[model samples]
Target: MLEVKNLAVNYRGVTAVEDVSFRSLPGQIVGVIGPNGAGKSTMVKAILGLVPSTSGVVKFRDRALKQQLNSVAYVPQRSQIDWDYPITVWNVVLMARTVHTGWFREPSRSSQEIVKDALVRVGMLELRSRQIGELSGGQQQRVFLARALAQQAELLFFDEPFVGVDKKTEAIIFEVFEELKSQGKILLVITHDLGTALTKCDQLLLLNKQIIADGSMKEVMTADNIQRAYGDSIFIFNREVV
Candidate 1:
């Protein structure tokens, strides 16, 4: 449902992503795996139009990204967000519906229902009335996810969704991903956890400033691929290929 071709992103002459290309089909979880500074996040930002690309084309369902903005949702790294903002969970989630509801119109009954359902899906329904700053880190992450879910996007992008959460919360987030996939939504998750990427994602993009490998987990998570993505400086202890 999403396609990126010959994509290159630059910041003041330093290339973040170079000639990157990939496609994501519906009902699939695609993991973009890389070490620090591998440009995984840059690639995602380019696709989402958060940053202007130096070159390349991003298409969603055969339409250019400009025309398909509503079809995709992005959950940025929690660290990038200012959780200290004084806003309720309900307000955060309701923002997602603004695109459909328009700037001047208030959220309709149907949109409100979708927002509530999204909060419930993310296990944040009870916290909906609570202030965002009052919640724990995991709860805050769930609020962001709920906002994205409320968008009802056909394609979703998550950047390091499991960074600092407990195992239980991580599992809950993965379960939410499964539910989204079951509903035929495409997911592209940029993650640093190799184990979770291998276990949870159907497809993998092993990158280190370039595309090292892209395919099914069995095909792309080989020892050689891991070595290339991580380089000789790092090691995975007791790693067993599934």
Candidate 2:
């Protein structure tokens, strides 16, 4: 399980996230949704220790999350990646094995096989030799997904995974998410998509800097909750949000 308590983050004396707390169990997909500048990404970064938190505690399986970094997989936003980097898709996914294989040592046969399998799962095996910068947006996203899979982590974080991807890639990612859920992996995804994909999550964390709502889709998508978080945005709820 994952637990976050009173997490907060500040950037250059400005508060980015405040009093964020949530718990997630295995075999569940939690969607973090909010409007722009809501600090959804910042909250995730704070939880992962990628950014310093002003105050908070992050625990996984009763221990501090930093102590179990090897069991965590993080796929940052595509914008954060340098697509111009001259690296092949295969090498990108294979990098995940470095945590276990050691940076200076060669990857073992099993590690190689794991990387291959991950690529195959994401349907990026054939593009393994291609440069990451040469692939389409969807294909590049799949490569990152493959890398995350190769890690075999218990907990995974994805930031705006469906952004700039084709429908096929979206389907592939959803399939992989279901597979990971079946394997008892915990997934926390930050997504702006609020259509069919939004309904797929077992829980939703609706935020506007701080958490406005955190519960099942039905609970978090209430009319008042949506209005509070999105603030008069043009959205038509399929169900009675009331």
The ten-residue window of minimal lDDT in model 1 covers 233-242
lDDT of each candidate versus the true structure = 0.87, 0.93
Best by TM-score: 2
TM-score of 1: 0.95
Best by lDDT: 2
Model 2 alpha-carbon miss at residue 75, Å: 0.7
lDDT of 1 by residue, 27-94 (tens): 99999988889999988988888999998998888889778888788999877888789899999999
The reply for model 2, stretches above 4 Å from the true place, is: 236-242
Estimated TM-score for each candidate: 0.95, 0.97
Q: Which stretches of candidate 1 lie over 4 Å from their true place?
A: 237-239
Worst 10 residues of 2 by lDDT: 233-242
